[model samples]
Target: MNIVFVMIPIAILFVIIAGVVFFWAIRSEQFEDLDRQGSNILFDEDLPAHQPNKHTDHDPQP
Candidate 1:
């Protein structure tokens, strides 16, 4: 009962802060390249054969 009184105000404050941050990101062009990023992930070209297997970051196991 008493806890709800404390929690309600905190939750409202958090919602206001999150809304402000989202608006700031939109104004700063943070979402401008969303389409480019998705397309880039699907369209990466194959690397050269001589380029020592840069695909996996781990060492090759025997």
Candidate 2:
């Protein structure tokens, strides 16, 4: 029961720290690229499939 005194102040401090960091990030434009990130996944890509070379059928030692 006495520990609540210590925990309550700690929790309040945590909330204040989190709010400050959030406001700092917002003021610095950290969320500006959020819309671009959502749209980037909709574009088509020309990537190729990865595969190993098939050299088992051809004999180079014989």
Candidate 3:
């Protein structure tokens, strides 16, 4: 049909673009830190507690 002529070229163009993007990602360092982010969530960090009103007489009324 007439649609085949248009659809075929569009599909080919999309495939080529996708391949270019995939290769670009590989060439860049996008996939370098694959495990560091995932492992960070599993461990807990030691953080200081929040201190309130160290040098002021106006205490917070709640």
Estimate TM-scores for all models.
Answer: 0.62, 0.62, 0.60
In order of lDDT, best first, we have 1, 3, 2
Instruction: State the lDDT of candidate 3 residue by residue for 1-62, as single tens digits.
Output: 99999999999999999999999999997899999989987785776566666678467779
**What's the residue-level lDDT of 61 in candidate 2?**
69
Model 1 lDDT at residue 4: 100
Go through the candidates in order and give each one's C-alpha lDDT. Answer: 0.88, 0.86, 0.88
Q: Candidate 2's error at 42, in angstroms?
A: 4.1
* Span of ten consecutive residues with least summed lDDT in model 1: 47-56
Name the candidate, 2 or 3, with the larger TM-score value.
2
lDDT of 1 by residue, 21-52 (tens): 99999999999888898888787787545555
- Candidate 3 stretches with Cα past 4 Å from truth are 44-62
Give the Cα error of residue 10 in candidate 3, in Å. 0.4
Give the per-residue lDDT of model 2 (tens digit) for 1-62. 99999999999999999999999999999987898878777874666665656775555765
